[model samples]
Each structure stands twice: as structure tokens, then as C-alpha cells.
Target: MNYRLLIQYDGTRYYGWQRQNSTDATIQGKIEVVLSRLEGRPVEIHGAGRTDAGVHALGQVANVHLTERPAEEIRNYLNRYLPEDIGIIEVKQVSERFHSRLNASEKVYVYRLATDPALHVFERKYMTPCEEPLDLGAMKEAAAYLVGEHDFQSFCTKKMKKSSVRKLEEIRLEQLLGEIRITYRGNGFLYNMVRILTGTLLEVGIGKLSPEDIPAILEAKERQKAGATAPAQGLCLKEVRY
Candidate 1:
């Protein structure tokens, strides 16, 4: 049977979503290890996307195939066996044709920036603190240029196997409590695209870059011209929809 899982995790405790040979652990590697132990065999799990270290996800999706267990019982098995930081929220039988990555229609990511003077140390692990007040007006104006299809080469790192051009469905900024939230909805994202975009918009909010300059940066198609990549701690995978 093939099963789909909705997972929530604190990425600060792991290297990232994908497995690697390094000493640092990863979310997928840990889950695969536990599942492998239970099934008395190896198992491969696929996630909707790869999140960076120190990031968090409220709605990460993954899929696995197994022959020994029923689909519903796999959730219980994972819950009982997996560590507390990672939890399988839901599990369902998916069509054999369904693939987490290929069938994905849209993805949403949110980047948080804390603007309060009174920093919460506990929350710092989950959010990026920017003591400098951000101008929401400027941020919104800059974000306006991000919506629609364009070549996001300047926003991403690494040369992609596919084209850098992508369709951005929505981009907006919202203030919640002491934090500034930047939400982006798109068909897909390139490596570090959202983080780089967030940092550039923050610069615009702080008077370092003007909204007018965004078009020119896009024209340049150079990664260095964009804003610095923000730390991964403030990034979260909000949702993946098919």
C-alpha cells in the first residue's frame, strides 16, 4: 500500500529534510530509520519539498510505500516510534499514481521577521529578530512587483536543471504582534529563492533598496545584486496543495 502523511516538525533539531552522509541528522533520514526498523526492511519516503536547516513546517507532506502494514495503522506506528519533534498528523492511502513532488500544484512559504524591541529569547529559535523597525508600506510596495511570472534567477542560488522562470501567484506582507510576516504563494520555488527575496524586501523596507530597483535587479539576473539570504530559522513551509 502507498500512504501519504502530513507532518509537522521543528527543523532546528535536524539538518534539513533530505538525508545526507554528514554527522548532522535530517528529518527524512530519521523517519526512514525508524520506519525501516519497524518494517524489518528498508523504506523510501518522499517529501513535497526540501526545507533548509533551522526552518520549521506546519504542513509538510510525505509519502511512503509498504507491504506489511495497513495505511491507517502506519500513522500510529510512526507516532509511537518517531521522536517528539516530528509527528505524523494524518495518513491516508493514496493512488499508486500519486507522487508528492510531481503532482504538487502549488506551494506556500512564510518568512517571519520580528520587529519588537523586547526580544523573546524562547521565540528567537523560531523567528528572526530584527530590532530595526521595518516600513510596511515600503515592504508592500516592493512585494507588489514579485507577483506574476518572471525569471527568478536573481532570487535563487545555484544553477537549476530547469529554467529559473516561475509563476508567482501571490506575495504579501502582514504584521502580527511584533513580527513581520512575508507570505509567498507560487507554482514552485528555486533553491533559497524565497529567503533571498525576503532579505531583499527587508532591505527595501529599511531604505536600502527602492521598490523601483526591483525590476532592474530582475533584469540583471545576477544573484549578487539581490538581497542577502536570510537565516533559515525564520522560514516555514506553510502548505503544499495539489
Candidate 2:
């Protein structure tokens, strides 16, 4: 049976979602180990997206083929065996063709910044601290150029080979008491794309880049043309939509 899983994890303790032989401390590696033991064979997990190390996920989705069992039982068993940081929120039988990555239609990521570093000391692990006050209006204006479909090679990993074209559906900025949240909804994202975009927008917020620079950055399609990739701790996969 193919089982679909809703997963949440704190990526701080592990590598990215994909399993690796180098380190067994990955979220996928740990879950696969437990599931493999349950079936008396090796198991593989297909994640909707692979987050960078130190990132977090609130609605990561994955699928695995397993022997028939109650979904709740599987969830409980995995939860009991897996580390406390990795959690299975839901598990259920899915279509044999249902795939977490290929079938995904949208992904939502949130990048949080503690604009007032002194205020969120304890929450530092979940957010990036920016002691400098940002120009919220400037950031918003710069974000406008980012909405809609575009080739994002400038905002992704420098060594990308696949097409960098992606449809970025939305870029919403919200300010809480002392935090700034940058939320991105897109059909998909290139490696390090969201973080790079955040850093570029932040540069605009700090007067380093004008909003007009966005068009040139996009046209250049050069990684150096964009700002630095933000720290992984500030990034979280908020949801995967089907």
C-alpha cells in the first residue's frame, strides 16, 4: 500500500530531508529506518521538497509503500521510534500514483526575521536577527517586482543547470511586534531561491538596493547580482499544497 504522510520537523538537528550515507541524522534517514524496521526491509521516503540544513517544516509531505496497517498505528509507531524533532502529523492510504514531489502544486515558505534582535532572544533559533531597522515600505515596493512568473537564476544557487523559470505566486510581508515575516507562495523554488530573494529585498529595505534594481537583477540572471543567501534558521517550509 502507498501511504501518504504529513510531516513536521525541526531541521536544526539533521541534514536536509534526503537520506545520505555520510550522515544518518537526516529526517528522511531516521524515518526510513523506523519504517524499514517495521517492514523488515529497507524503506524509502519521497519528500515534497528538500529543505537546507537548519531549516524547519510545518507541513512537509511524503509517501512510502508499506505493508497494510492502520494509518494511526503507523503514525504512532513512527512517532514512538523517530526522534522527538521529527513528527508524522498524519498518515493515510494514497493512490498508487500519488507522489509527494511530482504531484505537488504549490509550496509555501516563510522566512522570519527578528527586526529587533534584543526582543526575541529565546526565539533566535527560529528566526534571523537583524539589528538594523528596515524600510518596510521600500521592502514592499521591491517585493512587487518579484511577484508572478520569472526566470530566477539570479536568486538561486550559482551552479544550477535545470531551468530556473518558476512562477512565484505571491510575496507577502507582515510585521509583528518585533518580527518581520516574509512569506512566499510559489509553484516551486530553485535551490536557495527564497533566501536569496529575502536578502535582496532586505538590501532594498536597508537602502543598499533600489526597487528598480530588481528588473536588472532578473535580466542579468547572475547569482552575484543578487544579495547573499539568508541564513537557514530563518527559513521554514510552511506548507505543500496539492
Lowest-sum lDDT 10-residue window in model 2: 156-165
TM-scores of all candidate predictions against the true structure = 0.95, 0.97
Q: What does candidate 2's lDDT look like per residue over 95-181, in tens digits?
A: 999999999999999999998878888878899988798999999998999999999999988667778899989999999988999
Q: Judged by TM-score, which candidate is best?
A: 2
Give the residue spans of candidate 2 off by over 4 A: none
Cα lDDT of model 1 by residue, 1-242, tens digit: 77888999999878889988884389999889988887889888999999987789999999888774676688888889888999888988889888888899999999888787266567787788898877889888888888899999999889767899999999978888788888999999999999999999989989999998999999888999999999999999999999
In candidate 1, the residue pairs with backbone N, CA or C atoms under 3 Å apart (3 or more residues apart, or in different chains) clash, namely none
In angstroms, give how far residue 22 of model 2 lies from its true place. 1.0
On lDDT, the candidate that comes out on top is 2
Full-model lDDT, candidate 1: 0.88
